[model samples]
Target: MTMKGLYNSFMYAARAHAKWEIETSFNIIKNRKQLLILFIMALPLLIPAMAHAADFIGGKSAFGPSFFSPTTFYGSIAVGVVAGLITGCIGAGGGFVITPALMSLGVKGILAVGTDMFHIFAKAIMGTTLHKKMGNVHAGLAIAFLIGSGLGVTGGGMINRALFNYNPVMSDLLISSVYVILLGFLGFFALSEYIGMRKKSPKGGDAHGGPDEMTALGAKLQSINLAPMIKFDEHVVPGGRRISGIFVAICGSVTGFLASILGVGGGFVTFPMFVYGLGISTGTTVGTDILQIIFTAGYGSIAQYAIYGYVFYTLAMGMLLGSLFGIQVGAITTKVVPGTQIKAFYALAILAGFVNRLFALPEKLAQMNYITLVPSTAAIITKIGVWLFFGLVSIFAFWIIGTFIANIPKLRAESGYDVEDTKGGVSQ
Candidate 1:
């Protein structure tokens, strides 16, 4: 496939995943049972607050100040809001920015990964409505995938912890290096696509430019009669298509490993792997991806990170709250914004993240004594990256909010609500 085709496929998958996340978040908010569960999960925050009180009263406390802080709490919410805005407006998974944003806020890389995983886990649990999509799911395929993913999650978690124990700087370096590579590749392609669209049409084209076709690799894999074949897409084609369970498991393993290491819930990777690599029908891919996220994120967070004291519950909750609000606003704002502008922002946002991680590398390298550099110079570079990233994100957020506010009258009118102007305020 050509580079452009590959990029389109990636965007299509990412958009689908983002839509699921947004819908799930909204459902969780509207469901009383889910809200209650969320409340129960947040009850743990009281423990940290109580500990803080004890320390304030001149008593010893096991919980450190790091466990709960006002600044970090609010900062996490802001990070989540920005991520949600990108996801909602750009129609792609905004999760790519979460870890880097956390790291920029002085969060430990491992802790950030763990916290993000927990956030995704909480969202998945509250938002999952598998019964609705069960018809699209292939039981045999999901089972094989989960088995491999379990093993992959375990291995990935171990690697991260081992690096952290050996040298915290090394752990940060690994995580930063991974983001740099990923964001750089995605960002470059995204920018290229944006430029291509501008040249082709004054208005931006659809984010997903074309339909996905089965790849040559996928065709070859399906033809192989490896043991334990999985049948799927009976609804789509006669006799349905079958691929080896082994291949499904392999794809699951890669997805799990990346999810554990990056704390992205793996949905972004799962979609492409299933649709493009394995040639699964999109219906099956979507249903199966949702199931895999709940399991992969839950297992990776609780089994690997939470139990190890790496997960920050407060931050996770804060982000969840912020993203819920942000996603709604962003989705609505997209109605008024031009598609081309949204595409440009998406490319810029990814590039900003790439720059943030890339520049921060020098500081980690300097601390590890891997490179000779002045500490001040390293700090300056890192600061520049942080400013550039947050600056772009802030601008996007403001624009979305501004558009939403400005278009409120029109939005209200469309929704059959009348707006009345008062002396100093407007009421709907």
Candidate 2:
């Protein structure tokens, strides 16, 4: 063939090859979407099983304050680091883990909670700093929430002390009741918000009113002269700046009190309050919640050092290792999962936890007539039940993680393409 003809033939072959590659890419994309859906469907089953297997509770080494001893203090630091690492990785404050771990080590519930607070404070600060860098955290909102949260902690602490002195059992029950209530309300509220968002979407005119509703509520509040209205991107208010100050102080006091009393980081409540009541975005809410917890938890940890001094270094270190990787994995996963889905799942989880707390485990166990059953059979059944619950959870978690990992490349590609297409559309 002539040189020009030969070049033409080569071009034709290249075009055919390119078309084949495109077809293959399209097929891969289709398969990935299916995989993603399947993965999500499997998560609920997996998460519970993982929770059982993960040994989320029951550690004697985590029970008490050993901060008086350098060894214990150092050990607690290690534990805090591990727990903090997990919080960082999982997008949680790790108060759940730290408190339980401390309790297992013989730490009094009150002191363990205080120590956990200190740890949360430290980790939250770090997480907040990262979020701030990423521009996900709203400084104005965070400062506002901090004010309320700090006051809440202090108030909660005082209330706890008074109640404990008056009647420890009643105090415990009261706190538990509050937790149950908070959990229930939060779950319901979050679910409602999620539903409202869905309804407001273009698919439903009735549901499509979230922003309008938010605006209307904001306007009403602004008209009330609530004081200290710090305007961020969302709303402009007459006195929005002052709102977070007093409210945050109140929240802080209550949160502190709760931490001192029940040993929880209050993230669950705080997250909802910021989003619904505070009117901040979800990302900002999560970022701010983590930040505030760090400071509050830090103070609690220091107090532990001065008084009871119980910190388990070994356990903390181990936890830190596990949690650090988990956070990165979770953060990345968040990108793939729709925000609405994440919120709904979180709400459901909170609601479930609330329901679980309403019924006492020990009491239920006592009520069961296992004594009348065959000893060997009963023992086998119990062991199987425990293992099955956790083992399945682990498998499900692994499945979700694996699916997320598999789809990450696809998500990034799609996102990048969308951005380019949007830019191109705008330019034209």
Candidate 3:
């Protein structure tokens, strides 16, 4: 009798959790309406930034000439296109390119960071909520996490401002150094993952990092029970247990701080943290992540960067436009290519970014007089790294485009639908 009762109780809890998820989804849609207007209004202002030439007003906003030309406009498009292609093929690592790309174009480091964050915020505003996946979001978890993350975003923003205030060259050096460590780790892991997958047994388990899998950390976080326990995803936990708000906030703080400093949406990091660090189910984590990004990026970009005159609006918009279409095109090509090839490109692409950032660091340090080097030598080395970085990205993007074109017939036949390549409308 006791065993039977326990089974029934578990089933009931699972059902209740599912119902709660469904309710959450409805709320998300209802709230998104107001945000849509803001997205619309932001478009016109961004369009003008591409063509206007001005030095960053007051000189405090950034060191770069505020004036832009066709070079800045078209160049941003090209970078965006490549980034989008990468994103579409691999479903990740899109944010890694923007900061470096902008900086390499002679934009200041602070401006690049601020611009990238703005781009992310703009994109998030336009992102799809039409899928009705909102049910997977846990409001309680999101709210608690936001509390901690809010502080982190503020703290990180201040750190960047302080650094820029101290010395421009020092700021560049610091930002570049951060990128080197991050991209190096990201690229190495990507390479390792790709190589390991090739050697894996056909019947073996997934290559998810140990962090993606539950660990002692997740267990410890979940075990803590303070006042006002927040219950989320009863189905996953069997009994719909509660997590302390404080614990969730701490997790949020970690993600928010990194996102603010790096000028990214933080999805790449947050996904794993929620799943591994906080013991949240992957489904709920994804939904909650989307919710947090909209807030975090918006707050960080506007309050921290834009108000301080650190953002380049035109560049942000150009990247946004280019990446949007690039992602779509890349997504279409994935249907034609083998998955392994895509995986290889993912690793190689990041490594290319790694190389680009690493090579440029010496120049930044040289600028700060932290190292003995000729100015010309530093310039030459940086130029070479920039060339290599963009060269690799463009090659990959073109290869995908060419391959997709070559395989069009096969893809069309497979799908049993022909897309007309007209002069206007959907094709150009």
Candidate 4:
């Protein structure tokens, strides 16, 4: 490859990866096997929540917040509805809201992260199913990517715990800062995609890009003939494009690390990585992401966060229930709504998160004496930011639900009048 080739390779990879980061999101549901697993793994975490009312109800602790108040119940439901709407339609930005929303509501930072992961784990069990085609997955690709992701999660979990132990205030600031950056980047691209769509089709059409394909840069990398090569998705690729197993694993590790730290399923990161980096088919990528979320979220929530007493079970359960309804409604709305509007909403959700964290940062810094500021000023600003975020999210959720209601006759007509049984939502 020439110098220009090298630069292009780098830029192309960035572009592809950016697509993955912005486009990946979520879906959810349940099975008996998952319930058994959750029971076994989360038993310890839930026991604490089931504690006597003698325990502090709203009190914050290293363990987590005590639970089951009317306020907590309603609040968790509201949060889940908006989050589900984001995940169902936009395919990103939902999980990003949970931790920040919880923290703003006075849940401890670590607890909020853990609870979100646990909730996702439960949701994945319910929502995810493997490829309808039994042979859909490329075995070599799945194994390599999973190995890499597992390792990444282990490393990320250690880092998160180490930071918390080192300085709780610093931990809060760091997590907040990471969210601010991630949400800002996502929000920017989402708005850009929406704007591009509007400019191209003033009458309103789907503007989001189509299914990802292996680009020329990806093709170049696949031709390297590196050692430990793996041929994947031969059905889609005539020759079954080969890439080094090591390369595949490295991509998985990056995805896993980000997912674990953020307390998400990692689909948002993994989808693009597989499709663009490894050049996997979108169909196969979706299958792989579903499997990966179950493993990643479970391991991170139980082994990494829950073991350290950082999860909130009641909140997770509440969100799970509420998301089922919200995701269903939002998914239906997608059929009637324009992709441009979805992109706009996605941008708003992400930007709201960015603002929430950005405003909360100074308060955390002041707590650590990293900066000097009046407590009242910092608190007021943080309060405003959090409320503003909730306001935007509320607007997004109501709009989606209202749209679904308004379009019920149209949707029902399309579905042979089987609206109740044929919701056909996997609750992504």
Order the numbered candidates by lDDT, best leading: 1, 4, 3, 2
lDDT of 1 by residue, 57-84 (tens): 1112211123345777788999989888
The parts of candidate 1 lying over 4 Å away from their true place are 43-68, 202-213, 417-428
Better by TM-score, candidate 3 or 1: 1
Candidate models: Cα lDDT each: 0.82, 0.44, 0.69, 0.70
RMSD from true fold, candidate 3: 9.0
What ranges in model 2 sit over 4 Å off?
1-112, 115-118, 125-151, 158-176, 184-248, 255-291, 304-306, 310-314, 333-356, 359-396, 402-428
TM-score of each: 0.90, 0.50, 0.81, 0.79
Model 1, TM vs. native: 0.90
Task: Tell me the tens digit of each residue's lDDT in model 4 across 205-308.
Answer: 32232233566657877888887999777778576678899888898899789877777767666655665566677666665665676778888888888777
Candidate 1 lDDT (Cα, 0 to 1): 0.82
Using TM-score as the measure, name the better of candidate 2 and candidate 3: 3
Best model number under lDDT: 1
Candidate 3 lDDT tens digits, 1-428: 13222222222222222222223222323556734654553454355552243224212234433445568667887878777777776656566887888777777777787788887776665544524557877889989989988998998888887888887777777778888887777667667656866897345543332233455667788787786689987877577756788878887888788778878766555655666566777677767776777678899888888877787876787777777667766767889878777878876777777788788988888878789999899888998988998888778888888988898888778655434434235544
Query: How well does candidate 2 match the true structure, expressed as C-alpha RMSD?
Result: 17.4
Q: Global lDDT for candidate 4?
A: 0.70
Report the candidate with higher TM-score, 1 versus 2: 1
